[model samples]
Target chain A: MNKKNNLLQCPNPQTECKECPIRKMALFRDVPEDDLGWMQEFRNSQYLLPAREILFRQGETAHTLYTLFDGWLIIFKILDNGKRQILRFLLPGDFFGFQVNSIGPTGGYLHSSLALMDSTLCAFPTTQLRLMMEKQPQLAIRLAEMEMHDMNLCQHHLIGTGRKNAQERIAFLLLELFHRVRLQKQNDYDESSNSIIFPLTQEDIGDAVGLTSAHVNRTLREMEKKGWTQCQGKYLTIRNEEALSKTGQFDPRIIISKPLI
Target chain B: MNKKNNLLQCPNPQTECKECPIRKMALFRDVPEDDLGWMQEFRNSQYLLPAREILFRQGETAHTLYTLFDGWLIIFKILDNGKRQILRFLLPGDFFGFQVNSIGPTGGYLHSSLALMDSTLCAFPTTQLRLMMEKQPQLAIRLAEMEMHDMNLCQHHLIGTGRKNAQERIAFLLLELFHRVRLQKQNDYDESSNSIIFPLTQEDIGDAVGLTSAHVNRTLREMEKKGWTQCQGKYLTIRNEEALSKTGQFDPRIIISKPLI
Candidate 1:
């Protein structure tokens, strides 16, 4: 009945592990080349998801782990009353779907991941990854470090979600996302651009900050009117980052850049 | 000189690997005996923290990770405006101090930990643990799974903090703490009691639920009046878990009982 393609299974041939884009990020920067090759071999394929497509469902079996190769996704949970909370947003090089496979059938997927835009995810079979981890222990250590980093980030976000006001929540989310994107962009070590493509919708922002879409619109407009940021179409630029950071109490350095292992 | 014995270092020789109280918990249930022995040898000592003492501070360099040997502790972040959000309430055998060593000196600890009651913590040097993990790869894998599980729990808590109403928040927190305590008590494999010794102060409860201490007091009194729960001294018993869970949408099975790795 539906003519448009909602999801596409992309044919992905194994590429040179050394040239993988996410290798330069903190998640994989320190991985040895041999282990990286194992990862490349372990990867099943890449899948393309259209905007608004459900990458994984809350009550379904999730046996695959995904790496964000491109575009944006939001990991969210819907409550009994139909209220939603965005747990974390995925950017290029970020890893997700780890939780689903980590916690199996009892809960199925802890949270459902939805693509915010057309996204490409490199899928890896959990069983193969586990086997590979057994052969190469450092890979497991690296993955643990990555998990610790993710845990820390989520705890930090809880501060904004649990205690901060609406204005502060929006500010914190913006500054945090900007920093994460900037960090990912540093794969090429580029530092010239201070702008990023804002892929989030107002509704998405509302779910993230625990506010209504109307509240998000009002707060964002206020931020723009104050000259703290500029939002033109898809691009969001921090015009007065100092003031913005002060308002949000956001310091990116607080997010650990160094790997734990 | 103020000699109040702020930190009392308790002498702890390595215990038998098979006798660890927390070994039965999901975090370390699967770890081999040799790896457990390595953990025992790596522990520096256990420290006794008095009630209301700070275990760690924000912005302080952290070189150790802690295991809750006894009593209770709360991991929290204080906002710029002085509001506090309780990140997690650590039970006996829960891991705390994992962040300090993870992030190191770049930004130090992003949050502060406080003793909710007089507590004993088994401290392990992060560097030594890292060394041991390198030799025993499976240990690293297990630790990663532990971190993943913690991250998942925090993400779930965000739903109550960010979206749930005051009543729902209180209900969710109570049900969750009860479940965690029940699970921790399962170390003995005993299915005897439904009551738990709740060591949290009203302010601590408020911080966890994003409400004022006064509001928390009122909510507790209301719940008591409703016959859904009973609070006597420090012991809390779920009188009507079915009703309470329905109100909070609390589901314990959703928390992964099995380790990932």
Candidate 2:
């Protein structure tokens, strides 16, 4: 059970650990029930954020870690000239803002993360996490595995961003999100929906894929004409998965399901 | 202390763990001497690889992890069309080939590694490392930190690959390697040496930067004409670090000196 926070206009101040909605997909799913119970005490609050709200800013001193219990988020960096690069997308059950100040007493985030849609996150104090990790080596292992999994995903994104053309890149991104959503939902995912629910704008796709928004729009239109997919607004329906896969030269094998703890 | 293995034609089979050339720069530098001593047993074998030798191949089963004792190595992935992309470079004191098989029983190397020069490596069986990790939880933390450091590097590389121009990309990479070499060899590095020893060919640079050899050549020549640096066979001297940094928009802060473990 969660207590509603009246002052902050937060939906819940505390969320029951075992009954959490994303418990099945969360990082601690593999963690033992006893260990998970320990985390229940550490999760002090849950914050509900509106779309475009920055969860953390680049160069901001990171003092907490958050679990994205629901909704979409993107971690990005802005250059001195004001150009932005989307580093990685954070899905439900993902961890964010865990940059530990290991080298010195003060450290800041290398990238900024903003909520792509209305989102809920369970916040944990970094100090408590470090203490819990020291007490439970297995917890530390899970955290390490999470970072490894993140690294693997970033490497895969590198291939698409560096080598693939605009069309292939967009196709690859769509397919990746599709598979990720499928994994999170499993058989419960509604096939009748026909299209994947994506909250990202074309500019978001362009930023993520390292292409200009104009180029992304042109590529999506070309794919639409080819009958491979229908990309309208925030929804994409893959009419021909085979063609998209072939065009992107995408291999799902590169994606690590989970990191080995 | 370690015993010399007579059967293997190794240069040094029994290097005292404390006196290890990379002991100071190695990941385990933070580890207590007693805990660090445990690694002496794993340093049972050493392999010297000549340039162009493939240490491991993509899709091949990964059985061991190696620590580079000397010389250079590059981890790369080759596309279906045989176009290669350099994933990361391995230097002295760097760990290589720690592939976590989380999905299923059969797991392969995500990328292939080739020796860029005659390199000496101390090899350790992955199984033993895993077992050691179980016994020494701290070792697992260090390993995870290494992977995070790697991911940060890849993300920075991604920015260059996706957003930067050909000349900027080349400048950025040179600055990166120069800094890395400087970090690895702090005071012992000879002041008499004017240029950084770069064993990479222009083609190698091209693969690393997501460019063609011709493009890399043109970029290098352009930088040369501007009196930026002199690029000779296997050597690159930064004649003007300030100009190169400005052109590349290089920030050493992006690099993780050591990941927050």
Candidate 3:
């Protein structure tokens, strides 16, 4: 089933090569055939390494735009004192490293993005990507919209940083990620209850929510004591889903639905 | 020569009729003849209002969209507790009521767009507006972009509200208004550095910045003392523009340049 040696089979089962693999990874449905060919050419790319393996360091020239086929990636920035503050996490179908369009790296560096697991990604060459985008403007438009979407996600996450307390923000984040991962795993998982199964490390979750690792532990324990939620390693059981959302003042619509405008 | 009654003449003495009486507005240049005819009809058919007249209330359903010809307009929103927040102040060539294809009202209501002086505006019936837009899809697309731009402005303003401390935010706002007014006045002002004229109350400035009037006064005084900017009534002077921007951590590139996606 596997034509390439380094990469895994593209999660698509019982399908003809004509039907091909990526029917779901968001932009796959939107990107046209020739562009898709370019994406596939980009896919025969280098092997994606494990967590903490840096994609490209901040201040380094951004050379590749990743089409995330599998697993999790975190975008972060390193402060002057060399402490890392994680800014955001991308899901299965999301792309990253798009501040590449600017004239220069004005925001110092993009810190570093690392795969939380051994994820497979299609890496498009920046120059080719631009040319292909010019040839196919819809992809470019979608890319712009997607970038705007991520910026909105960051703004939403900033509420956790500025407005909400540590506990509330964590709940809100878990719920938000649950919806995204749910969309991906919908065909595979049971839809009756808590079918979404993206397990996140407490450390990573803390980073995404802008809290200290210790604070993450303390907040989870507090929520568990209150029977708001149950945590077992990376796995969480939503004891009272509605109550959890309320604590976060979480509007599912913000993360789930497209902007009405 | 004044055309039909109710339509205001461009204050500038040198303009011929075919040149649209004023050269500053870009809306009519590329538009089709039919659309222009519709617009001219809308202009002649609409009513005129005197200076400082309230056009509509905040949350009021805007059945009419106003195409400004002459005089200034104030767009402000009244909050839940009846506090007014100024979203923007517009000169000639601005339009209000984004409810063209949209059924009924949108989220933010149409506020009382008062004329700072005796003003003329063209009003199109919503049904006719839809017909006009269907014929000119490009204009519709431009409208989308304009709406998006305004939304971007609002998002940045929200960023100021959520992220910035009062002083930096206020300074940033003053600089922005000065820059915009300067651009607007370059068309008509032959004399007076005080061409940044719009008699907007200090209270209006406070509303936009989410500050109390007293707080706005204090911030303005501090700005004056530091020589970052100056304000005398509606007249504003930007002495050190670069430093004011730095105070807000403002990246003008994001504001000025279109994203090359």
Q: Which candidate is the best by TM-score?
A: 1
TM-score of the second chain, each candidate in turn, equals: 0.88, 0.90, 0.77
- Residue pairs whose backbone atoms clash in candidate 2: none
User: Can you write out model 2's per-residue Cα lDDT over A69-151, one digit (the tens) per residue?
Assistant: 87888988776666677888888888767652112124767777778888888887766766676677666667677777776
Off by over 4 Å in 2: A1-9, A100-106, A191-194, A259-261, B1-9, B100-106, B191-194, B259-261
Instruction: Give the lowest summed-lDDT range of ten residues in model 1 chain B.
Output: B98-107
> How many Å off is the CA of A214 in candidate 3?
7.1
DockQ class, candidate 2 = acceptable
Residue pair clashes in candidate 3: A58-A110
lDDT of 1: 0.75
Q: How many backbone clashes does every candidate have? A: 0, 0, 1
Model 3's chain B yields a TM-score of 0.77
Give the TM-scores of the predictions, in the order they appear: 0.92, 0.91, 0.61
Highest-scoring model, DockQ: 1
lDDT of 3 by residue, B1-261 (tens): 211233333333422224564323434444655456555554424346677666665455545566665667776645334666566566566655543111122433334456666776655554454555445544443343344344345445544544466787787676666555555556667544733655656777677766778888888899889987778765677777787888865554443322232
The CAPRI quality class of candidate 1 comes to medium
Question: Each prediction's DockQ?
Answer: 0.61, 0.38, 0.09
lDDT-wise, the better of 1 and 2 is 1
Misplaced by over 4 Å in model 1 are A1-5, A11-14, A26-30, A100-107, A187-190, B1-5, B11-18, B26-31, B34-39, B100-107, B187-192
**Residue B75 displacement (Å), model 3:** 11
Per-prediction interface RMSD in Å: 2.1, 3.1, 7.2
